[model samples]
Target: MTNPMRFNARIFDESFLDQCDERISAFYLMWKAKCKEGRIPARSDFDPLDMVKFLPGITLVDVERDTLELTYRLVGTNEVAVRGNDPTGKKVKDTFLANNWEDVWGNYSHVIKNKGVAFDDSDMPNSNGVMVGDETIFVPLSQDGEFVNMVMLYSIQRKAAG
Candidate 1:
């Protein structure tokens, strides 16, 4: 359950990748490698082949600066299965996932506002309707290097240890 007064997402420096799972860390590292002169990488900077391993868990969201709205541009198969529906073409504010929508939106907003990255972990609903630990990373992408127009996310789920 979420504490109404607190947000679970944490903003971290890009160097904090060491704290993440190896696969998750590699995703961030790949994005980092695509950066040019510390500028955010554009969506075109990535090649699909390089992200093959993480494709099923990836999501690309479009940011609408004028309305501060975010929409699901692409939702991976794993992500769709986990959420039990495809949210592609739907606004984030209207998407219903187990995680708090406000918190999720806030995290994405933070990434856009700062033109940086963020990391969050929380229990999420799986396809089986059971809760599982999930870790996610949100990275900003900008075509012009001055404004973030998209947020790329990758998530991995794990069962709790007994």
Candidate 2:
């Protein structure tokens, strides 16, 4: 479902495609392919049917325009495995402690404010010194055809066993 005529300004460090694991790179590519005219795509633009193959690792976040808050509307199975639970319906900010919330603020805030994509491998920190690693891509989604109002957060993390 890719269009050869469209430009690809794929995010996630841009070089992440070369450095990250295969799954992460594929997720990033799929996201970029699904965007609307190389611009941020609205939530409605994404249909699970077309995204079925990638559904296992895709998570959709709805942006509350009034508060600029992010809510986890859909948390993928693989993501749940990494996070150890489903986070749907929870505010992204509420998931982190006050002291650590800033750790991930930039990833989402940048996309929301700039109407662009944000890429990061260090959005959330593993301060406990665990042997876990994760990569995150925050893509803005527009509403009313004028402003960004949603975010598609595709994150891939190492599973303790796999």
For 54-149, candidate 2 gives per-residue lDDT tens digits of 687778788787888888898889777655678899998877321346645766777778776665553222334343456667777786645787
* Candidate 2 lDDT score relative to the true structure: 0.64
Error of 1 at 87 (Å): 0.6
Clashing pairs in 2: none
Q: How high a TM-score does candidate 1 get?
A: 0.88
Against the true structure, what is every candidate's RMSD? 2.9, 9.0
The model with the greatest TM-score is: 1
TM-score of each: 0.88, 0.73
